[model samples]
Target chain A: MDIFGVPIQALMGQLMLGIVNGSFYAVLSLGLAIIFGVLKIVNFAHGAFFMLGAFTAFLLGQHLGANYWVALVAAPIAVALFGMLFEWLFLRRLYGLDPIYGLLLTFSLVLVLEGGFRVAFGSSGQPYATPEALRGTINLGFMVLPIYRGFVILAAVLTCLVTWYVIERTSVGARLRAATERAELTQAFGINVPLLVTLTYGVGVGLAAFAGVLAAPIFHVNPSMGSSLVIIIFAVVVIGGLGSIMGAIVTGLGLGVVEGFTRVFYSEFSSTIVFLVMVLVLLIRPAGLFGREES
Target chain B: MHLRSLTLPLSIVAVLALLAIPFFPQWIYLVFVMKTLCFVLFACAFNLLLGHTGILSFGHAAFFGSGAYIAGHLVKNYGVPFELGILAGGLVAALLGAVIGALAIRRSGIYLAMITLAMSQLVYFFYLQAPFTGAEDGLQRVPRGTFLGVIDLRNDTALYYVVLGIVAVGLWVVWRTVNSPFGQVLRAIREHEPRAISLGYPVARYKILVFTLSAGLSGIAGALKAIIFQLAALYDVHWHTSGDVILMTLLGGMNTVFGPAVGAAIVAALNHYLDPFGAWVTVITGVVFMACVLAFRQGVVGELGRLLKLRRPSRPEQTADQPARGESQP
Candidate 1:
């Protein structure tokens, strides 16, 4: 009943944990890929927006008695609106400059957002309880799983799939892809590329906020939470190839599972496993597993 | 009216001001100068890659952090001399940089930056868990052994002067490299990699060499700080330190020799003075980042050079034909 000197039940539990973590990675990285495709700016502040989502959801629950469902739908919209406004106001100016300027701008936004939150809320995390409907554990033959964690996996997968479909199949998705390929040409053809860009950024961040609300129950609402995961997400994006949606989803989930297994085998390397994998991947395939060759 | 003509007097004034830091003899001045010198070296070393080579490495703190950790451990744990430990630190960081730079340089722009970042974070996590680093509590009370087996580095004046001399040498080395044939190639690679490659330049090799040099120098700075403060911790290797160096260099001016130094001094002084308002420091740094990127991408020294009609110490042809170029901008 034991695998690798650990109980099978414990092993399954870790696997479940891995899937849960992977779900968050999948959702976040998917958002990153989309944003990069449409906006062509690395939104370094995506992590901050994630934190904002969690904080906003927590605030609603604490002050307004808004339930988890309301927070779930409202959080993404709220963060999305803010992201759209930010895109329209600031990101519009950075179009022709080198990409580093855009990165620096977003990086600064992350600093301001994180520092502001830290100043208002102390460094210590504030816990959010699991919702009443999802507080209990369900037996899964080999192991027991928390309903909230299971819900996260299902929701994250669903969101990624829907996003992929919308981007890869729908007519609007065609416009998005066409714009990504030839923004000027697309603009010449009478499509509102600029407005599309703003809307795309909103969708990308809405995805992150949705994940953030999901994370609020699992991890405490801490200012540092989003920043910590963001670097790892970047690694996932690189390994999968930037702007590669399928690559992001696969790499994100795969790394999460690898992290879990590392925990079960040698916990010391848990924190470093993702990055180590990234180094190996970059050494072997500089363009990433899914990225096209540099023209 | 070319500012290049004033390099001699500017150098003299700068050296004199640095020399005056330790002569004041106040404990505050020593600590401030010591810390500032290390950061100045750190920022300049980083700028070597970012500004000159056009490789934006986000994981540079790996060298800085590892440099401090190795030097502190050698001196504190193995009873090695301080000078030896510091050299060892630079060597270790250089080795790490070579390995990281090899893989990292294969990808440019954000990918390159992220690779360095992730690798450094791996190193940071390694340090945090490694017993020698003392975990979350951090390694403390490291001994400041004699410098080169003779001079007592424990004295505040000695340590201050030593740091100042090394940092000055480091800055001069950066300035020289930027103007050298090797540095010219780096700038070529930065501005246009494809052209450089087409010109029969071993672009990758030059990039890696510069990357190693920058890493080693950054390590030396970290080692010097560790010995001076007698501590090494999670903060030294954090991603934030990497960002801090970037902020420092950009705030002072990217693509300029003396800019990172000024940037480092300003940032270090801000941290020192605003110690009580810890969170505000980060917020203010963020604001500065936005301002610099938005309005003043040329940086302070770069802007000053433009205003003063100074030519960057670039290739000879550019400097000779500067007047035509100046008219194009104005």
Candidate 2:
């Protein structure tokens, strides 16, 4: 029953929790990587958009009596549509400028979204209950785990794989890659690069929303939820390297485990350790763990 | 051309407005304005590095919060005079900045931002664990010691004047620095680092120096704020505070001297008025930021400057005798 002076069950449970956290991290960071790959802009509002997705789910479930399953699908799509509008209406104009401006623009968007949400919902977090189907627990050899958490992890992994496949394997993915590398040439080929750009933004934002919906049950839905988590995600993005999807996934999972271990060993440092790793990674491999060197 | 000379008059008018704040019936309003002014100074200091030097620091709250902690400790423990406490707090921040800036200048762009962020996080952790920071409770119930051993700072009127004077002095220093030759070098480095370096200018040194100066000034603002509030909480050192300052800078107009002040004032006032709206304050703030970035890129003061044509004179407009130096010192 005991392992390394800790209960095997407790350790296994914590690991399960860690994996769940990692799943969210992977999904969110993947979205960021996709956007940065093409736009070269660090989307500071990625977390806000994610929060919007959760809130959208909350509202939909409240007003339309939509089930959790319905929200899980619709929230991301809705957020993606909104994101496309933002890209078309605003971010399109900032393509050729310094990436800092893009960062600033997104930072501002965060303020707008977060402030607006706070006004609407108040500061207190609202709970979104897990569906009855997921209310039970599964007993394993060493530990008991929540069925809902397992579902979240499975859903996240499936999402990540589908995103990876779409971006890396499909003809559409080829075009998106082409647009990222050479927009003018892609446009010259009559590929509608502008439209692709907008879609990319939407997809990136949509992914964030999906993560938000997934997270709503675990973490209470709140306006300020995005602010705390986004910074860590940013660090993850940095450690993983911008524009590297695999990097994001690997780093997200790895850091989540590291964070879990830290919590067990040194609780005080659980939060700051991620940033410390980021600093070390930057010094050791400035381009990031998986990023290609900029020419 | 004659309007250029109005800078002095405009500054004086602004000072007068601040001086007359006590005449208002709402004591809370005066305190609010004082808070805004402190933030304005903080934002302006932030701009020295961000707007002029082209380095966006995400960890500026380290200096700001550290300054607050030092001031709080001095008043609560050592019983130091207000002026000395504030001065000591700024000095401490400057010292810390010297070290942080030295390490940070090695990187550029996003990397620099990350490094500052990491450093600030380190400081935040230190404060969280350190005994002097009072842990989670924070250094609370700080005394409003006498200003220069003369004016009683416990009085709201007295505190208001002290804050006003500090803001004025801080603004003046920023203005003077921006116009000075050293400031020009900092700008040059921002606009074109390689070109400035090629001209035999030590670009790194200039950047680090400016960063330290900015940190020190921000510390002063934070210290004054701690004295005014009689408390130094964990929130001061949080990365969110850094983001708030950045918001103030962007909203007001990063490049202009008074823009951050105006932005800070507006945001502080918004917080007061929007308190009734509850959580929507964050949503509104986010919306405003998004709108500003998408539509009002020039920011409030920047737009005003453009509309009024209060632009600073170009290098060419300056006396033609001083040719702009090239990177390579011939």
Candidate 3:
């Protein structure tokens, strides 16, 4: 029952926890990659939208008596709509300028969202109850896993696959790819590249909201939660290669597991392991693990 | 046309006006001015990288906070002179800058920003876990120790003058650096990196050097702040501080030499006045950020410079580079 002088159950538990975290990373980074690909703007407000998703769910539950399932379906849609509006009104002007302006604009949005939420709800975290059906524990041969966590892993993986499917297989996805590659040409071909770009931004942030709702029960729902998570996701994107969709998903999951194991062995470094990995990756491969060199 | 001839007298008047701040107790608080001076130095140093070198480093808080923590730890525990502690802080931060800068400059634009941010997060985690930093409570009640073994800094008036002098010297260094021949090369690199590289300039080395100088100056600001407040806290190292510095530089006009100083004062004043609003301060700051990015990219000073026709119409870009760079002769 011991592996390398540590309990097998403890390792297994960390592994499961890591996988759940990986799922969130995978989903979040996928969104980042999508936005960066199509808009050529780094959506700094991605994390803000994530927080918005959780807050929307929390408020819906409180005011409208919406259930967990209702929130899971509605929060992302609402956030995506909000994101599309942001794209239409503000983010559109930033296109073709230095991407840093986009980052600064979104960073400002983060301040607004996080600060506003802190005002409405104190900085202290508010908890959301795990759904009744997924409240129990599951026993595996090596470890006992919380049913909610298992559900999280399952749900997150399914979300990633469906997102991948939509982006990779659909005709809409082909148009998106075409726009990302040659926006001017795509427009010449009668594709509304502008609308596609806006929708892509919406979809990207919607994915972040999806991860946020998924995280609500596992982590305390708080204003500042997504701020830090988004930074880590930025690292994940960097390590995986910016704008590389497959790279984002794979590196996110891999780094999460690496972080989980680091906790088991060198617990003090748990918070910093991903960043350290990023530093190492940059040193070895400046273009990132999956990114192509820019001309 | 004679505006450039007035630069010397204007600067002297400004300094003398600053010297008079300690005397005016009712109108302007000494502590507020001291804090603003710290940010002025900090923001100006940040612009060395941002405005001059065209590198957007998101991890500047690392240098600032580390400087604070290092100086605080040395002065409190080891009983080092305040000057030595400050120097040590700058040296350590510069060293950190060199390492971080070398790694970061390999990538440009957004990747560079993300790398610095991640590294700073790593530093943040270190401070959070390190025993010396006191985590949330921070390194508190640090002594304001003597300056060069004289000048009792425990007195607010004495400390204010010292802070003012140090900030003046710091700003002068920034001004000198920006106007130096080295600075022209930096501008050249910022304007076009590939061209600079092809022109035989060691682009990466220049970048790392500028990053080091900026970090070192920023470290001095952070260390002075710790000495002034007699505390080094977590917020100094937080990413929000990084964001705050960026806002200050951008809003003040990164291209203008005196812009960040003006920007820092304005932002510090905003924070001072908005403290009572609780979280609305952040909302307002964000609104300002949006406005600045969208409508005021030229910034307050930049717009003013434009309106004043600070430089010849033939050299539009140089207008912001140095408003007083020997262009006064008719």
Q: Which ten residues in a row have the lowest lDDT in candidate 2 chain A?
A: A286-295
Instruction: Give per-residue CA lDDT, model 3, range A73-130, as digits (tens).
Output: 9999999999999999998998888888998899999998999999999899999999
lDDT of 1 by residue, A1-295 (tens): 9986899998888888998999999999999989988777777888888899999999999999999999999999999999999889887899877777788888888888888888889788999888899989999899999999999999999999999999999999999999999999999999999999999999999999999999999999998888889898888888888757888998889988998988888888888888888888887987989997544
Cα lDDT tens digits for candidate 1, B1-330: 444556678879988977876766654567878898899999999998988888899988999999999999999999998888999999999999999999898888877877888888888888988889998877799998787777898898888878887887887788788878888788788778899999999998998899999999999999999999999889999999999999898988876777788899999998898889978878888888888888887677667666665445555554533432111111
Give lDDT tens digits, candidate 2, residues A189-233. 999887888889999999999999999999999988887678888
lDDT of 2 by residue, B1-330 (tens): 322455568778887877777997565577778788889899989988887788999889999998999988987899888898999889999998988887777667765776787678778888999888888999999999798888998898889988888878988898888878998898788788889989999998898899899999999999998998998989888887887888888888777666788889888888789888766676677667777767676578666545444334453443323322221100
TM-score for candidate 1, please give it. Answer: 0.96
TM-score against native, each model: 0.96, 0.90, 0.96
Better of 2 and 3 by TM-score: 3
Off-target runs (Cα >4 Å) in candidate 3 are B1-9, B310-330
CA lDDT, candidate 2, residue B31: 75
Candidate 1: which stretches are off by over 4 Å? Answer: B25-28, B310-330
Question: Of the candidates numbered 2 and 3, which has the greater lDDT value?
Answer: 3
